[model samples]
Target: MKKLTLVSLLALFMAGCAKNTTDSPTMVGADRDEHGCIPSAGYQWCANTNRCERPWELAEVEGFDNTPQLFEAFCTGQ
Candidate 1:
């Protein structure tokens, strides 16, 4: 009755809290992609370099166009 409802509500609240911590993209230092890149810190996966990188910085160093298409091609090594 009331006890069961209280337990259910508590469980639901805990689940919501857990989900926020695990799935949030805005979790600062805890937010990392599958490749361990942290977007908040401006690091993204670069398949060409096989590491985390800043696209604009990489483009400058590699002498490539800074467009999104070029970045994708370069990052994907296409």
Candidate 2:
């Protein structure tokens, strides 16, 4: 019985360690509808500034918004 419990616990722990792909967006420049507020087409949704920005622009506008880390994750492609 102890051996079975240990095996079960190990399996559960491994399962918990698995990466959750659904938690993050898919790519950096994907459509906004697909990846929430992350902008596409050389744009980024700035949460702090509460606005969109082109790559040339900084993220320090009045409504400076921020793209989710997931957006960068998507860019990294896991």
Candidate 3:
């Protein structure tokens, strides 16, 4: 009985860690690339000049010289 209870608890924890596709919003605008998702703290895509920009592309536009820094900025919005 103890073993069964432990197994069930582990299963529940794993299930909770799984991603919920239904909870994620559909990707929109030109920013979408092969990744199928945009970078943002609140899942918000970057919009400039009334158009959505991909995170990588936006980083270049914002004058980030290094790819790592650009990626960090894109994800953190700093």
Candidate 4:
């Protein structure tokens, strides 16, 4: 029983060690390369204009509102 348990645990560990080559789901409506910035909400990255933009503003243009504000937001603090 102990050997079985050890083998099962080792198998699980080895399985976990296997590299996952499949691409994972990216951020909705935005990707790191597309935005040219890191993946973070709230003015972290902007793909439309290739600059930092607020997530809230991006949300505005998510569906039908493709206004300028939705493209980018220049805050003071950055």
Candidate 5:
């Protein structure tokens, strides 16, 4: 019975050590959108700039409110 328990525990430990190759941690920029906007890095598609940009940063630079509506308005050149 002890041998069986020991073998079971060892099997579980080895199984835990055996991880799936594809189950690794996600790399940065892996969540980029179709326009290459990395949402994880706070980037979104900006039509006016024709590229990905962080809304808050764009608001600060372009003198617009940092709200989602304003971001959309500004990016759409409203």
Candidate 6:
């Protein structure tokens, strides 16, 4: 009886430790949705600012901007 109980407890502990990928929420930018950010043709997504920015641009609490810009130094056009 003791051995059986220990084995059951161990099994339960192992099961709890197992990862539940299906039940876990998917992170932002993982899917193609407005809530997520997608970089433009010449820009990259900045997770820190949650915006699409140029490689040289510094992220500063900015959000996603899909607008097109002309003569812009940064890839803000995206």
Candidate with top TM-score is: 5
Error of 6 at 57 (Å): 27
* Backbone clashes, each candidate: 0, 12, 0, 3, 0, 1
Give per-residue lDDT, candidate 5, residue 34.
90
Candidate 4 pairs with clashing backbones: 43-53, 43-54, 43-55
TM-score to native of every candidate shown: 0.61, 0.32, 0.30, 0.37, 0.77, 0.33
Give the C-alpha miss distance for residue 32 in model 3, angstroms.
14
TM-score, candidate 5, is: 0.77
What's the lDDT for candidate 3?
0.56
Instruction: Please give, for residues 1-78, the per-residue lDDT of candidate 5 as tens digits.
Output: 999999999999999999578864478768878997999899999999999999999999999889999999988988
Cα lDDT of model 2 by residue, 1-78, tens digit = 999999999999999999877966667655574325555566665444445545344523323344545444333444
Q: With candidate 4 superimposed using the best TM-score fit, by how many Å does residue 15's alpha carbon deviate from the native?
A: 1.7
The models' CA-based lDDT, in order, is 0.85, 0.56, 0.56, 0.57, 0.92, 0.51
Query: Model 3, clash count?
Result: 0
Question: What clash pairs does model 6 have?
Answer: 69-77
Could you report the Cα RMSD, in angstroms, for every candidate shown? 6.4, 12.5, 10.2, 8.6, 2.5, 9.4
Report lDDT (Cα) of residue 47, candidate 3: 29
* lDDT per residue as tens, model 4, 1-78: 999999999999999999777687555735554545545444465545457755656556555354445444332223
The clash number for model 4 is: 3
Per-residue alpha-carbon lDDT of model 3 for 1-78, expressed as tens digits? 999999999999999999777755655533433444444422233323234455456666776664655655655557
Span of 10 residues, lowest total lDDT, candidate 2: 55-64
What lDDT does model 2 reach? 0.56
TM-score of 4: 0.37
The candidate, 1 or 4, that scores higher on lDDT is 1
